[model samples]
Target chain A: MKHSKISNLAFTGLLAAMALVVFVLEAQLPPLTPIPGIKLGLANIFTLFALYFIGPMWALTLLIVRVTLGSVFSGQMSVFLYSMAGGLLSYLIMRLLYIRMKEDRIFVVSVFGAMAHNIGQILTGVLLMQTPALFYYLPVLLISGIITGLFTGLAAQFSIKALKKSPISDSP
Target chain B: MTGRNEHSLSALQWILIFAGLILLLLTVRFFFDLSDGNRERALILLDGKTVRTLDLSEDQTFVLDTGYGTNTIQVTDGCVSVTDADCPDRVCTAHGPLTDNSMPIICLPHHLVIRFEPGHGDVDIIAE
Candidate 1:
């Protein structure tokens, strides 16, 4: 796994930096849809890349670092709870299913994890807002989750394959 | 671990699973939208509690100061909308009007949510 001069911890930090950069940059873009809580989630690429290429622990670390910094930089501290809930739920689901499926099927893991992420956010919103009317966004979120998950998943899959060509991989 | 299980499904199988899930969600959405648009009153909530009730029949506009932010809500033509707001995104202001029970007009920054109480919920005898 040490194909490069970078240490394991340093490499994890590098991935976290990349994830944070993407997260902040993506926030600059206006909402793609009028529906709230919907975004491309493009920053997930680096985290997913870490999950498949580095390790689950490193991936979790990257996700946490990215989301925390992302909220601070975006100047929207209110969304911090929703982001944490979505990020953790997605990571757990991805970690669970990634091992059961083939390595090439990263898209599947991404899709399911993305959906779980949406559900987690909406649940938090409902609880915090104390209104069941928020459930109305469930279907919209699910649909967006699948589409964005496939996009991020495919990007990560390609990056993983490209990195693997030089014999670089990690264990959970 | 290579992670190849006997029960591991192929790409096609995963697609089928996704399709089934999407179909189910669509059905749920259909039912949610099926509620008749006869709602006569809407609740203006701030931080999970109702602050005021608006009669959709009598069009009116008022400024709601939630301390966190402010929103100018307008009720017109049996619909309610946030006409203006000091929130960062102004998503609520842009939400136009909410006439049905499909989805509430939400202002995350202001912690404001305007939802229509369905016809079956109650009879607005006082409004009449």
Candidate 2:
């Protein structure tokens, strides 16, 4: 039993590390233009996978760890507070929706999560900057969220299928 | 059955939300009467440096010298846009004129950022 718990913890840590790698990789990509606020949001796949497969608390832990480590690695400690605000809100929203709404549709969840994430981030930006002008970009960001969320959702669905097929988890 | 019902409802909910957003957007686009209001402005930075302040009043055009070439920004009637650019992506130009509140005209290769500023002269946040 103790070994099982230790392995779970280790797995969670590994997932968080994987998330950080995704974040860094996404950051390194040439930012898409035409839409100023758009991003690949690569780390969200891990978060969603953890949410459904492992559990909400583990997902939350992975999210917090990933965000913190990603911030540290990026050397943008100044935006740490904003990212925290965004991350917390996103985690809560995903939890609420997952519990209250019974949708196995990862696509919808991804869209909702992405939208909520943008709102949280923009709100944090407003709070940090002390400028309501930041609200003006909310709509654009919302639209971008839907697009990226759909992409990540599809990726998660495939990953989940692949994981299910793996013989390593044959313990019924 | 419960899962199916919930999935359908959630889809409908998202659609309604997006519809409401579009309605709000159309209203803001057509009815607000921004013709005579105060024009917002943004600072354009290039090459990791501040280059100039741009007025989004449809009355000014500014040319920027990106390392690779040149780009032109035109502002008119409460909107700002990249009229021309030399980047291969031309994404900045494709963004067309920007009238939204917080976003700016950005050209990444040039390391340029354009974001809106409130007229009240508040300075609490710096762009990241």
Q: What is chain B's TM-score across the candidates, in the order shown?
A: 0.81, 0.56
Per-residue C-alpha lDDT of model 2 across residues A1-172, encoded as one tens digit per residue: 1226566677778889889988877666664756544677779898888887677888898989988998788664644665677778877877877776442466677777887888887776555444444455566777778778878876886787677679644543
Instruction: List the candidate 2 regions with Cα displacement exceeding 4 Å.
Output: A1-3, A34-37, A101-103, B1-128
DockQ of each: 0.42, 0.20
Q: Residue by residue across B62-128, what tens digits does model 2's lDDT show?
A: 7878665688988788777888876644557877776543445655444455655433332223333
lDDT of 1 by residue, A6-107 (tens): 566788888888788888888888667656788899988888888887778888988998889889988878788999999999999999987776568898
Q: lDDT for each of the candidates?
A: 0.81, 0.67
Pairs with backbone N, CA or C atoms under 3 Å apart (clashes), candidate 2:
B58-B75, B58-B76, B58-B77, B104-B114
The ten-residue window of minimal lDDT in model 2 chain A covers A127-136
